[model samples]
Target: MGIQRRRSWRFILLFFPLLVFLPLLFSVSELHRNSKELDQDLGSKRSNKFDHIVLGPAAGEGLSNRLQCSGLEALNKTHLSHISHAFNCSEIISFVTVFAVYNSSQSDEKLSDLVTVGNNSYSKAARSMAILNTYINFIQVSMPKSNVIVLSDPASELLIRRNNVSLLHIQGDYSRGMLMLQRIKSYIAFLETRYEEHLQGKHHLNHYIFTDSDMAVVDGLCDMFHKYPDFHLALTFRNNKDQPLNSGFIAVRGTPDGLQKAKIFLQEVLEAYSSKYMKASRMLGDQLALYWVIKSHPSFDVKRFSRPEAFMNEIHGAQVLFLPCAIYNWTPPEGAGQFHGMPLDVKVVHFKGSRKRLMLESWNFFSSSGSDISDMLCLILKSGRTKYDF
Candidate 1:
């Protein structure tokens, strides 16, 4: 009887371990199955979300059909396909200029008053036309081989005429305050369209440079492209102490990562504008949205130019290269003895603030032959304004 009891105890000890382990083994199997199912579900949901955001709900549609329906295939074939990538600055970069012109009936009294040039009271649309014309003329003289694309309303198309330049009429209400955020959206759309064109074997563009209509190119930007080969995006610093970066002048490279960053920037701006909390905190505009984007993205290869005397002052991600403001984005300061003529080194002039009134004056001065540029530079250097000038 004692021997029989010993055998039974041994059996109990062995079975006891099995009993404890069986439940745990089954539980672990169940958890693994559930985890796999959960991952699949989440992945599907994420895919759907991405589709809705990028393709406008009809994500199943074929690429060719969408391109054909959107009339982008023709554009791609015409503008993108034939271009070659030879590492030449002109071949790699295209200058994109945007303008929103309003007629007398659409513009307010303030805009109307601002439009008047000298003795003639021109419409706001006419003034914008003049500004764009001057810019185009300057670009032609300075960078004849450079590619230019102008985005404007249909009405303003009549004013711009250049054989080498491409004109795209973007239909939208670009009134001063209404749909202000849409400007950035439009820019993203244009960039994406170009990207698609590149993917379709139509064109090969490495970079896009964006500027406002009031801005004019005084020199070729080939050196800048050669200088920053790795940077994905370049931004000019705003003159305002509160706003450090200006979206007015942006140079973005054509890469998957760069495009994705731009999309994120635009999305964040849209979300911030829509958010009630953020809307109340600050003035909701493209500049503010850009500020948020730059601050949010610390990893991006963003180059900021932030010298007080430089045209672009502060970049968010990288060190400042200190490009001369007298050449890049020369915004003339206010005060007596301020030089109004274009300096030799000035590449582009961005007319901002009350100094925007000087756009017409500068445009006329630069277009004419009689202005003494040397004397103007002397006056600007003598006046204390050039120290902190934008």
Candidate 2:
């Protein structure tokens, strides 16, 4: 009996450690398995989030092929701004302006030669500053309740701020190429950031109008919304070919479909920049990329406007409504003097090409004459408020 009792005690002691260690070992193994599964789930979610954000084409395939194969519906929704159910076009429309200026050794010389400011020699950056300030002030006067955002380099942020414009500083080396590529990238970046803000419920705009620094608004654009209520996107054209659209002025609706199209367009532009075909074809710059996007994607509801007297001219293609160019994107006739008369209905002036010199001259004339700057420069002078000079 004693020997049997001793054997039983030994068995209990030996088996007790096994009973405890086995359950602990099983628990640890189960925990490890669960942790691995959780990690995999998170990884998959992350991958799915970024699945549609293809900045360029994938390996071993051309961009055209990749675009054809990938269904836009399968694109990740989180990367885009959720269309607000409460969007009201009347109350929310934003004007987006972007400028990129690099300070180089020849920048001053470039500015002085680009636009001569009477006897005063202003640096290229200085002229840019003056132009932007005038543009902002004009917008404020014409569209007092409108939202304005300016995206620019850090050096120009203060200048933009002084004009009571919302400034977003761009960070990068912008000293490369003709800067047109960088401008397009900046536009995309701003759109992405705005999308993020909308997702966070911080932004509520349903429409956006993007313009360049050298343009000024002289009249209200409220009628444009009423006229083009159903249009998704609108772009100005420089000619009838509808080949290369001017990206300087663009209007976009913030609908889901519109945002999706914009994303696809920007992605295609990136692809073109990196593709060898672009190099061979000499299809360089943002304008060519835009032309390609419009050509490639025929289903995007885009309108092109071009009428000599319209606010924005050089429009082509079908379904395009003409706005008076004399008002919206007014550029003086070649060889015309700065004091040349313009139509009374002129709403905006675009100082493109060699016409930039006229902008400074007109601004000076109006400011000195005590004439209402809101009126077209030529109209004010024609009213006999001041004599035309220069």
Candidate 3:
């Protein structure tokens, strides 16, 4: 019994320490492993490559494939405004206006392929060429310091190169609805490239304006950022409740944080294709998508800018301002009774639908001291086109 008791005492002394320390050892191991995992998560996020978001099975047919073609696998989302704190933006400021123009083949059946001129239908390519030239003329005369980037096909290479404009060749099947929707993805990709360039010390940009080719800019846009430093996104409202906004004119800051937020908003807009408004917005293009996304925000008011003609709202912790279409994106009415010359306050003129003819007329009436404008007129006239006769 004595021997047994001595053996039991020895066993208790030896095993008790192990029993007490084993749990602590396991806990420390778990904590270290967890810390390592957390560090990895933070490290990946700090990279900010925007690769966390993956498009799974979605209703937007060929969206994933098209995005892949644009060298973008995914885009990260920013739910907090404080995310901007992580960006080390450069002090230099520059502005760029982007236009996505796809020169479709003559055999294509898209509505944009054929524009009606009175009783006769003419190829839209001529109009596209003419309008693009005139737009460049206006930009050179109005905002000579701003950069012009055109996302177009190979056919536009000579025109873009000749004008000293930066041309980014785009690839993908721009069929059916993709013609309108794919441009959004292209915009995001261009921004991503620009951001990467900034990191490499090759470029520094401030404001990025994405607009349609048919629009004419009569005033500068860079001052807008100075006017509203807090607002990250600005768009125009049509004053119609059904189609409250037009997606043609969109301005976003080019900083890292601003770019991220803009990407988030545009990504949400792309995802709206699966929403209920898809069918209604089919004929209207991206307006319904823009409306749905804006409405989906936690704090969005359709009438917020009704009285002020311009209003700002905080969405996803970022300020999104809305300007009246009449002021920023003015579209001329159909009849001559409502028609008058471009107003002094109008910053951009939208030659939407049949009003493309009016663009020629307006350009003729508008005068500028810039020699480029005069040269553009000569070119249009040399084509033997008066009143857009094909």
lDDT of 1 by residue, 91-164 (tens): 45677877676555644455424444444455544655676776676566556666678776665535546777
Candidate 2 lDDT over residue span 2-68, tens digit each: 9999999999999999998999999999999999999999987644421011222211122221112
Model 3 per-residue lDDT tens digits across residues 67-139? 1111211122111211132122322333344344455585656755565533344465556666676677666
Model 1 alpha-carbon drift over 4 Å, by segment: 1-92, 106-121, 153-159, 238-240, 255-260, 274-284, 297-327, 334-345, 370-390
Stretches of candidate 2 above 4 Å error? Answer: 1-90, 104-121, 154-159, 176-178, 242-244, 255-257, 273-284, 297-327, 333-345, 373-375, 379-390
User: Residue-pair clashes per candidate, as listed?
Assistant: 13, 15, 0
- Better candidate number, 1 or 3, judged by TM-score: 3
Best first by lDDT, ranked = 3, 2, 1
Could you tell me which residue pairs clash in candidate 3? none
Q: Can you give the lDDT of residue 78 in candidate 3?
A: 18
Give candidate 3 regions above 4 Å deviation: 1-123, 153-159, 274-283, 334-343, 367-390
Whole-structure CA lDDT of model 3: 0.58
lDDT computed for candidate 1: 0.53
Q: Which is the winner by lDDT between candidate 1 and candidate 3?
A: 3
The top-ranked prediction according to lDDT is: 3
* Candidate 3 C-alpha error for residue 101, in Å: 7.0
Candidate that would win on TM-score: 3
